[model samples]
Target: MNIVVCMKQVPDTTEVKIDPVTGTLIREGIPSIINPDDKSGLEAALVLKERVGAKVTVLSMGPPQADLALREALAMGADEAVLLSDRAFGGADTWATSTTIAAALRKLGFDLIICGRQAIDGDTAQVGPQIAEHLSLPQVSYVSELELAGDSVVVKRTFEDGYQRIKVKLPCLLTTLKDMNSPRYMSVAGIFDAYKKDVQVWGLADIVVDEANIGLKGSPTRVKKSFTKGAKSAGKVYEVDPKEGARIIVEALKEKFVI
Candidate 1:
């Protein structure tokens, strides 16, 4: 089986900072890591590769620096890596991004595609489904468990209340949750081998997509403003008997119109 995993390099949110003047992320000097959910998806693909003798490829779209991210995937046991990078792909929204990725996927071909549920930077959770829509492929999101059947895949889809088991045929897309699997670490040998391997890079002209349907020109949404969340005030605390505490809590709820 040919498995393709969509991965992204995102700033570590715990270390992220906002620019007060520009209202944008302060990316300079910040460390970047694979998106957690995407890493889990890669782990899932690696597991399948080991079990069924599948060939795994990692795909990503970002700036030139994103090559580092692809190398990390190679170090994690992906057989190959491809990076889609171009000035023409700048300032793209989820729709344009998916269009470009889907076009590339068509050229690369795949029996299965795995993506993260959402990106930490955007938190939109829209790109994966958008890619499926563009490719006209069946997709299941929030997959917590995955197993291969005869020519089909069985997955456990997670929900807030519970989970549902689903069976989908081959050539389908799946968006995985971070809890799906624990990602393996890169070994010394793998790391050295990863640096030696070449990452195939493709630009806009390489894929068969309309120029008008990519980059900022094709994006339907624009950021009018950006800002960071404000700090919240501390909550009030009280030490009292159970009965008094109950009354105070009820009164507070009523005051806040939450009761």
Candidate 2:
């Protein structure tokens, strides 16, 4: 089987800072890592590869620096890696981004596609499902568990309250959760071999996409503004009996129209 994992490089949230003047992310000195959920998805793919002898390919769309993320995927046991980079792809929103990635997936061909539920930078959680829609493929999101069956896969789709197990046929897409699997680390030999392998870089010309349906032109959503959160006021503290405290809390909620 050929498994394609869509990965992304995102700034480490802990190290992220906001630009006070521009109201945008300060990425100059911030380090980047593979999106945590995507890393787990990659681990899931690698596990399936080991169990069923499948070929795993990691794909990412971003600036050229994204190649580093792909190289890390190789070091974690992916058979191949592809980086989609181009100036034309800049400023793409979820729709345009999914369109471009779906185009590349068509070229690569795959029996299965894996993606994180959402990206850290953009928490819309729309790209994976959008890609499935673009390709007219069945998709299951928030997959917590999966097992390969003949010509199909049994997956457990998670929910806040519980989960549902469904058997879906091959050629489907799955958006995985970070808790699905523990990611493996890059070993010394794997790291050495990763450097030896070539990471294929493709631009807009390499994939088939409409000029109007990619980049900022195709993006329907725009960020009007961005800013850091303001400091919150301290909470009120009161010393009272349990019954009195409950009454006070209820009264406070009523005053705030929260209840």
Candidate of highest TM-score: 2
Could you tally the backbone clashes for each prediction?
Answer: 0, 0
TM-score of each: 0.93, 0.94
What candidate 2 gets wrong by more than 4 Å, as runs, is: 19-24, 239-242, 254-258
lDDT by candidate, in order shown: 0.94, 0.94
Tens-place lDDT per residue, model 2, 114-184, is 99999898787899999999999999999989889999999999999999999999999999999988999
Q: With candidate 1 superimposed using the best TM-score fit, by how many Å does residue 44's alpha carbon deviate from the native?
A: 0.5
Residue-wise C-alpha lDDT for candidate 1, range 1-259, written one tens digit per residue: 9999998999988898888677678888899999999999999999999998899999999999999999999999998999999999999999999999999999999999999999998899999999999999999999999999989999999999999999999999999999988999997889999999999999998999999999999899998976678757898999999999999999999999999
Error of 2 at 160 (Å): 1.2
CA lDDT of 236 in candidate 1?
Answer: 90
